[model samples]
Target: MTKKVLVIEDSMTSTKVLQKVIQKAGYTAVCASSLYQAKHLFDQSMPEEFLCAIVDFHLPDAPNGESIDFTIEAYIPTIVVTGREDEQTRSIIINKNIVDYFTKGNSQFYEYLSRLLGRLERNQQIGILVVEDSRAERNATVALLQRHNFITYAASNVADGLAQIGQQNNIKLVITDDDLPDMSGIKMVESLRQQHSKEDLAVIGIAYQGRPGLSASFIKSGANDYLTRPYCHEEFFCRVIQNVEYIENIDAIRRAANTDYLTGLPNRRYFFNRVNAILQSPPAHISLALLDIDYFKKINDSYGHDAGDAVLKGLAELLADICRDYQLARFGGEEFCIFMPLALSEACQQIETLRCRVEKLRIRFEKQILNCTISIGITDIYEGSIDDMLQYADKLLYQAKQQGRNQWISSDTKHRS
Candidate 1:
């Protein structure tokens, strides 16, 4: 489901900018210029429908934080955009149960709002592993994380920590104490580093006072960060937030590297790596196809490169909708590839279906509706290599283009309906 955010600000320029930023971050923004408008919008929509809301401290009608109070009254996770940072204003906003408040004094505050929204969005899927031998300490740590909307798993010892990490997927951050029942925290960090890289998972060690060289030891053992015991709750949250943000940024970079920019599909590098890995233990029944858009250059030459891009994106969406069970990739330009885990006959039928779907796909490109079709070449996996299968599929693809466009050719060079 698409996430919706409510934006209530009186400044037209600021409202437009905030709306643009929110939408660019992949959210639907419902904007209102006044407290009355905000109330009407809130009443019309279910309160639970909004993932979160952003409200200005001063509105035209509600000049004194009334809008913030009203929005919070709706049980929405609210974020305040206040031009004031006075002690009394800060205290009142903090007590209002908002996600967070941002000062609009800085020029980069809007960008920060976008970043905060993204963090809250990702918090739903992020899991933090808390490993502490002291049950009280473990519970306290979990409570703090949970207050910030993080899913937490607790383990009493290093061994249990490792076990929990293995069992829980999407566990991105681990908070561990210096001492553990089964093993030293430093040793556990070292062991964890061997299994998970820093880009995907982060480890922060918490040490007590009088533990000389504890922080250094944890760092040397591959922990990303260390916090001393009896620390402030705000300090602990900041450390955890920074580490999680680092992991998320690195993961995003890795994803971008593995994906095609134009079509939002896996790129050739990912395709080759996955296919090679699969061939190591080749499945009994497998199939692969190399698909290409027919007369793609003509589309670009006649309409524009933008139209070609639209056609490619349209085709990618169609393929994604239909090829849920297959590994699909945009190999470059107008070429795409799909790997099917089915028998020869089934694979052929699936490809024929995809071909018909592509034939019927129409994309509205500035001033005109563009119809596009694709030619596909498919082959069943043999007792040979991935390269061999790809070569066979490419050959069949060539036959498809040679005989006619907008059709598929299997190993038998026969078109299936």
Candidate 2:
């Protein structure tokens, strides 16, 4: 379902601003001017539809943060925004069961809110493991994570925590207390680092304030971050978010490096890496196909370059859809490759189907209805290396193009039109 955010604010200006921020963060904003209006609007929809609620601390009719109470009572994670920046206002909002509170002091507040909303959405997919012997502490940590919509797992000891981490592939972050039953948290962090790099998984170690060198030990042991036992909620969240974002940013960078910029397909380097990994075990029957768009330069000359790009993207999308069971890549301009663990006959049939589909595809660009065809060369011969397979496939592909456009040629069989 497309999640929504409930914005209860009396000011039209603030409501409009919040709506823009929420929409930019990829969520719909349901706005209300007062608590009564919020209730009426909320009654028309299900609570589950809302990702969270952003409410003004003081509404005209329901003054003094009553709207915040209503949202909390309705079980929606509430984020309070107040013009009052006093310590008492901050205290009152922080004590309540809310996601976070923001004081409307500067433009950075909305900027942070935009980021926070995005984090809440992403947190739904991120699983966090809490490892603490104290049930109370573990529950509290889990509760805080859940308020931000994270998938949470709990373990009472280091051994159980390690087991959980191995079992739960979705777990991206581990928050562990220094004192554990099976092993010290620093030791656990060190053990975990042997298997999971910092970019793959993040660990935050918690040590009591009186523990002089424990925090530094945790850091040296490969914990991404360390938290003090008596830390405030704000400090705790900052550390958690910092560590999580570190992993996510690294992932984003890796993906960018491996992906083709225009068509969003795997690039040549990534394709080789994947095919090489598969070649290590050597499938019983392996096939590779090199495809080139027929008359690609002609298309670019007849139409605009934009239309040519549209054709490339359309072909990539088709390849992704039909070759879901195989590895695919855009090997450069007007060229693509697919690696399949299928016999020559099976691979030939699939490539023939793909060629026919490309011929039938109608790519709309501007006022033009453009169509293109692909010539494919496929080979089931795997001579130890992916490079050898690619070269053989390229020869067959050239033969297909030489014979006629929109046809598939197999190394072990006759060319098909």
Candidate 3:
């Protein structure tokens, strides 16, 4: 799949030049002579198409940058191309918060556009909550963020900042000035970090004056990084971008560790970790159940190992599908586990749904018919020991086998020991 570039230009020469540059740089080039044509192409193209866009200010449809402005409004990462390069013109361009800008040059705008495209390719969106008591400073930080292409929200103080943080789940970065009329920013960062879950997130403390080792204190108070007031734009952007990317990388890594490979479910390690969590309290009204296949070993032996593998996978799928509201896991070979946070009787109602679904699964392996059923051993939390619960369930499973397979034995009633 080639990365597609959408170039909206009215100039035939410049359009041809950009198309050639794009091809040379190894990206497929698409050209639109007017905004209508550009929109039409966008509507026709696949949703996943078009990595980035370059829009010319003046077009045949309407003059004075209509196409470029509309493209930016459409929420695509767009670079504005125009012959005007005066400070006033640049101010207007920057005010639109365009991702990048390309001025007409002898080298052609393709490489410059490609630089922004490169950034867009690796670019990750950073959610930044800017905390400022003064409206002036808040507007200043918001402008700075627009120049750097960061998604930002503004808050007046500690309370507002926390509220915005709660509202935006993607918030990876926070910038707060130290001298709020109420609640010093350093104290806010400390309090937030404690409640903010040590998961991937960054905080940078900003202050107008140097107040005796405040930077060190801020870092120690659970901020990832910090900056003094009256700083350069590049310095601020660098620190903010770095911290956001760091947290995002950590989040990606944690996800890989906890997710299961085969069925994309939470694997046994995570399941047991949760089980330990559920075991912290006495098993008063809580229940646990261990489900096993009726004749798993014989199914594999008679229908080849692949069929056995299919049964196990099919059972796991059915378990996950039916027990959508239950704590479930691929416990091990030929065995799966479910934990219901309710009394034995209520949990039985929930588990029976899964039992009936699996019992009806007629898994086909070539000509051989593979019908399956499962037996479950249920027990209460009863003083909160996983060891005791496992023993009780194991005893019930043995009982089910003795009484004949494909039957559920409730340890809460059938075997109290």
Candidate 4:
């Protein structure tokens, strides 16, 4: 199918160029020059027909971003293009989570736009792998996916197929036939189901010698979608497409849950989850640190909140550069935390190194320059649970603040068993 994209851009010349580019990229494109025209186009174009949309931040009708909101409410993935870099535009773009914002004059505008569309198109296809014993059945399944333009892979029976699965990354959907020499497909599906969440990996079973409603057993065996022998090719392909889409949606949501909005780090909830997991079967034992910026409150009060944000962002960059392997998070206002499994001593040393880099970080605002200092509280996990480790680190961090505001305090306290 030729992919359909509705472009709501005000510049007729730019829209014409975009139309040519999108068409050349093999998508059927529609261009609208204003909010009212966009509404008319949307009304005429059915939702199922258009794959997604691109919206301009300021249309002639709604100059302050009202039209983009309307488009997003329609459940289409929309990318925002804007001529203005105002605070209001940035806030709305962040709040609505529109896709991404691009200032039109940024020399890379055309490249970014092209990349966004490509990502959306690839996201639609969703990858699948089919495993069957019969050459004809396997080819039929592979043919069904290829006809739909879905990127696909196929393997014969249990052993060869599972080997393929381990080697292939992002193999979201799997179709397996139950009978095999190495192992039964039911057992394969069960093993995968036990190892991965239904949302992350979808398993569908196919059988050649089952009675009516036999697909129910496979569904019970943990397939997100089911199919039987003698199935219509169209129905089978549609089922495969639906499962792939479902798993991708689920993967997206899971990622969002694991991420933090402000500093773009893993949030505290996700941090604790890793800590708990480490305590269960921790290797060589890891170290945890409770790091806080000293005099942060004074900085927040002296400069505006925006500068304070700049400081936090600057520090986050520095930390990521120095301790790339360790997991870090903005623990709370003016405080952050890090956990490094194989490098507790090294993590402590790195945080101390970061403090020196952070102190030299001269943040410039409007006309003034500002410098900041950070203090770290470090503890290695040699005893106790994750909670106790945090408590130990927090206590040490409290001590670091006392021993003058810019020092790192590494305590010999044990906080996990």
RMSD score of candidate 2 (Å):
1.9
Instruction: Tell me how many residue pairs clash in candidate 1.
Output: 0
Question: On residues 1-417, what C-alpha lDDT tens digit does candidate 1 reach at each position?
Answer: 788899999988888988899999899999999989988998889876787889998887988889888877786777888888899988877666566777887787878777877887788799999999889989988877765668889999998889989999989999998778789999999999999988878999988788869999999999999999889665787899999999988989989999999988989999888888887887788999999999999999999999989999999999989987778899888999999888888888888888888888889988999988888889884656777888999998898899888888888645443
Determine which window of 10 residues in candidate 1 has minimal summed lDDT: 408-417
Ranking of candidates on TM-score, top first: 2, 1, 3, 4
Off by over 4 Å in 2: 413-417
Q: How well is each residue in 161-261 modelled by candidate 3, as lDDT tens digits? A: 98888889878788888888769989998888877744566888885564758888888888888888788655776687677668767877876776566
Q: Over the full model, what C-alpha lDDT does candidate 1 score relative to the true structure?
A: 0.86
Q: What is the lDDT of residue 203 in candidate 2?
A: 96
Worst 10 residues of 4 by lDDT: 408-417
- What ranges in model 1 sit over 4 Å off? 1-111, 158-160, 381-384, 413-417
Which ten residues in a row are the worst by lDDT in model 2? Answer: 408-417
Write down the RMSD of all candidates, one decimal each: 4.6, 1.9, 6.4, 13.8
Clashing pairs in 1: none
Candidate with best TM-score: 2
Global fold similarity of model 4 (TM-score): 0.64
Model 1 quality (TM-score): 0.78
C-alpha lDDT values of all predictions: 0.86, 0.90, 0.76, 0.76
| TM-score for each predicted model, relative to the true structure | 0.78, 0.94, 0.70, 0.64
Candidate 1 residue 365 Cα shift, in angstroms, is 2.8
Better candidate by TM-score, 1 or 3: 1
User: In model 4, where do residues sit more than 4 Å from their true spots?
Assistant: 1-120, 124-127, 143-151, 179-181, 207-211, 228-237, 342-345, 361-371, 412-417
